[model samples]
Target: MEDLVLNWDLGTGGLLLLAVAAVAVLLVLIMAFKVHAFLALMVTSIGTALAAGIPPNRLVEALGFGFNPTLGNVMLLVALGAMLGRMIEASGGAHVLSERMIQLFGERRAGLALSVASLLMGFPIFFDAGLVVMMPIIYAVARRVGGSFLSIALPSAVAFSAMHIFSPPHPGPVAASATVGADVGLVLVTGLVFALIIWGTVAPVASRLIGARIDVPVPDILGDEDEKTGFESRPKVSTIILLLLLPLVLILLNTALNTVASTTSDPDAFKATPWVAILRALGETPIALLITVFASMFVLGWGAGKSGTLVEKIADSALGPICSVVLVTGAGGMFGGVLRATGIGDAVAESLNGIGLPVIVAAFLISQIVRLAQGSATVALTTAASLMAGVVAAGDYNQMQVVALVMAMSAGSVGFSHVNDSGFWLVSRFFGMSMKQTLGSWTLIQGAMAIVGFVLSLILWAVASAL
Candidate 1:
């Protein structure tokens, strides 16, 4: 079905009200009525679509606009990550890796070790993919250390978010830089500086505070802890490290090639080279994860004397537990998609655009509002940057000022992660937190990151102006 043209325009105020109502109803259904998250999301999506003037005949199509693409992106990563994680967990690689980490970092600072690793990993990996891949290690560390799961996991989660939102090579900041004409290299350096500051200061403190109060246990999503055995047969820590690094290296290689290609005068020709194409293909997240999974089967599976049938069962077991997680995440995407399709984000952005705020402040506020409205950080960042493009071009700002604007918008795009955001569900389910716990902790963590990032950007803006 073709995209439905909205015949009846809900004024900006009306659209905003509808967006708020949709979220309210969604929360009540899940929180009060105790409805399943998937059902609540679907119901809210359908209702919101209709109320926003989507024609009845095209309702299914409108739903597909968000649902299909989200599942297409999320399913592969979640499934493959789960499979890789299962293999590692079953093979006791996670245990060995965690043991080595504790030995290296000492138990007193295991959370610090995980955070630093995650920050490094986050540089090359997207948030969801990185989080999924890191969960087994996070779980192993939390269990061995014997404390609140969030204390160990939250810092790593925030680290990934910090890198993903602020840094380059991740689509959001890169796209925003392009849209607002910021220097990509400057943005990368500035982003890394701020991302570290935000992650280092904010993540650990929030993790400890929330972890102390909430006490989310390590989830059994990969496999039961009791079922794991044969520790002596587990892969050596070096072997486990190689298995974990495979995807990261592949992904990094792909990112480097693409970056090099983009910088060449004829980017198309550079990318068209067969060698480049082949390398990029290998580096694609799904393909990279797929390669690691197969590699694990050999080194961790057959090499360990596990039968092919047993390896197959291990992979199969990973799928069943993740079905609900995948569906609910996709449904969250569906709800966000419905909101996006309704044009509420555009309505809100246009209103915010006219407010005459300073460029940096406007960038953050516009991105935040659009993100809250639509649930996609990329969409929010790009939209805010696009809206600010004319103003930025006319302003004749220095490179640092322009970079500050991009960072401010990037920060805004990350805040207020809630039910509509797919990452929220991903974190909630993977960590075994109830919806309330997720809201109380994860949401606040993200909010704090955003606020601190924005403040830091403001400082940068001031410094740039003075220089």
Candidate 2:
């Protein structure tokens, strides 16, 4: 989180061009030269940093500092979530859940059912973790229902991305709301409304339209070709649901209590209570996931009649496949970090600061630019909010207007996820999608979500301004 302390003498125009060139080179390296994504990202990061005038001594430190933080944030979640997912997959729990869903919703409506489930689950879990845990079930449903994987996967993926970008307890929106001094409750409520509306309406239509063009066969997660043994003794549906919901319920409780405590007259009194402190600690994301993983060991593994040794092997096996995912995601973060070190995001936002545009529109546009430049939505949102905060504070705005602007910034933060973005790789690798397929499907989904969310926010801002 420490800002790179180098002096950047480039103007906004110069830095913006540099950002474009960096991304173009990255694409060429990956798409044309066939460089491994990890090496390409590292090369681009170092080259970009040097091009942007980063001192040589600070170069390695800058890249490591950027790479390490992202790696730290993601590694535990990916590893633990993967273990939990593997347990569910190996024990026939995912098959059970998918079967039940297909029966209730019917094969034709399976995609809708999965998406709704993902929306509910996405409220609490981070996008990558939620997607990882849900993948087995998604795969099972796709196998049973017999259709393009995109028909099922895109809707569910959009749901997670929508919730993660817009809602609180997911860090990005929470931090942006705080920076802009918007009411957290208002932002949370507004975000949920807009996100759900878009997820229900825009995302499905977009998914169907795009899914047809991208033909991705489901990858072999459950070893479908040789899985008769595990499927013979499937776990109960109720147990599978409980295992999935446990962490979500705990995390939601933590968010609710913290919101209440923050709003109360004596915040410290709530924090000082032994039970509150303990629950908060337990509900911290890694702990919540850990608790869920342990519980899953019982509910989805041993209780399902698998041996402890088998469970250990399943969890251990999960780590091997995702090692590449973790490193490439970290390198993606490193690229973003190098861009940040060169002060590109700040320069663009600063240049956009005073152009007499509507505050909400400005927020969306600035956030979108920063997002395209850097590839981390959280960084884009927080940096844009910081740049725009003074203006929002000084303007004559009503409560809902403030909320709408926060939503606008949140929406813009999700703009156009591409090669430089880590989430791009996460989706591409997990779903067995190629780069062109990822662009046509995942990238386009993000663009649709961002634009639709922004449009909704614009309407809200206009209505609130009128009032």
Candidate 3:
């Protein structure tokens, strides 16, 4: 079912109170007790709904109703994404790509190589995957570069965040786009613009300043053993580029072709072109991804002399984590659906309808408030998206304006990534940072990224309206 936002009977005063209560509980859990975001979100959502006097039996029924459909839509995509990412990693694609990137940048620019891997891998894979698989290489590079972990880690983190927030194939942007009816192509374009701001400008510069203060260890568990898988020093750069660029090129072509058709009236005339239509179908994300997977099987596996079993192993490896995340997110969505069914979403949305801030400003403020309190970016994103779904849908939202609305929601997601956020402690544990240091570095960088996201999205909205 679509995540529709129906109207509610919640009074403005009641909503304000509920909003405050939701914010307070989430913050208390994340910051005070340091709870896992997934748990924290479930806790706060149920807690707030109850506090709002949602009937317990009704709420439970709503939740039960929401489970399957919410999870079903995303379950396959997450699994498929995980499957694709695993094959890329296990096939020694990471090793091959890293070798080539380092060679291109030269040994002196090892930091840059680590940063680039984070960016490129991030495009097609999830953040945790990027972290788990690439961190070892990052550690090796840091040691070779003679820089502190922060130097390499900072750039790598920056790149990962950029891709996580900006790139498709990652569930966040994909779901956000699907939720709001934004064109995938437009979202991609907008996401790319925002990512550049973060990675190209904000992340690299922030790393230089922030990296100076922290020194993370490459955890022994995450460290690479010296067993030479007899992996080649480098795969052909041409082969690597072709594999890497495959999905991006396909997705972009899909977007570009759609964009081209929209700008003119002769749609079928354009579509009638055999070469264009053929490339369009072949270059679609799903087909193109399958192509890349096959390419990796041969290029990185056989080309690099890995056993055939290793190829099978790659596909099997993605299941555990992908299943966990997809299920959890599906549970979260079901939880959201219950909130909507129980009238909590509408109550929350209606309560905020008249706040003095501009719509965008209010969205950011609510997101930041919720984020600081809860520390689950996904929760923040989903919650904000659910609430705003009503507002943006009610208004005449052009395709592009949806980006601003979504970014405002995303801005909320990044606020206060302290104890509640898994990423916060992941950084703290690896970097050996005190809580205070995580706040200084990880917390600050995330907040910085979130704020910048909002500011730029606002700029885009204004420009769009004026046009």
Best by lDDT: 1
Q: lDDT for each of the candidates? A: 0.91, 0.85, 0.62
| lDDT (tens digit, per residue) of candidate 3 on 127-234 | 644454455456555655565667677778878777777656556666766776667777777777787677776666666788776666644333233434343335
User: Which residue pairs in model 2 clash with each other?
Assistant: none
Ranking by TM-score: 1, 2, 3
Residue pairs in collision within model 1? none
Give the per-residue lDDT of model 2 (tens digit) for 1-467. 35556555777888889889998998899889989889999999999888888878888988986799889978988888887777777777778888899889999899999989999999988998888878888888988888688888889998999999999878999998889889888888988998898898766786678777777898874345236534235778998888888888888888878987998899989978999999888877788889999998887677767787877777787888888888988898899888887788888888787787878889999999899988899989998899888998888888899889889999999989987788888888888886778888888778888999999998998899899
Task: Give me the displacement of residue 365 in model 2, in angstroms.
Answer: 0.8
For all candidates, the clash counts are: 0, 0, 3
TM-score of 1: 0.98
Off by over 4 Å in 1: 1-3, 228-232
In the order shown, the candidates' Cα RMSDs to the true structure are: 1.4, 1.9, 6.7
Of candidates 3 and 2, the better by TM-score: 2
Q: Supply candidate 2's per-residue lDDT for 134.
A: 86
Model 3's TM-score against the true structure: 0.63
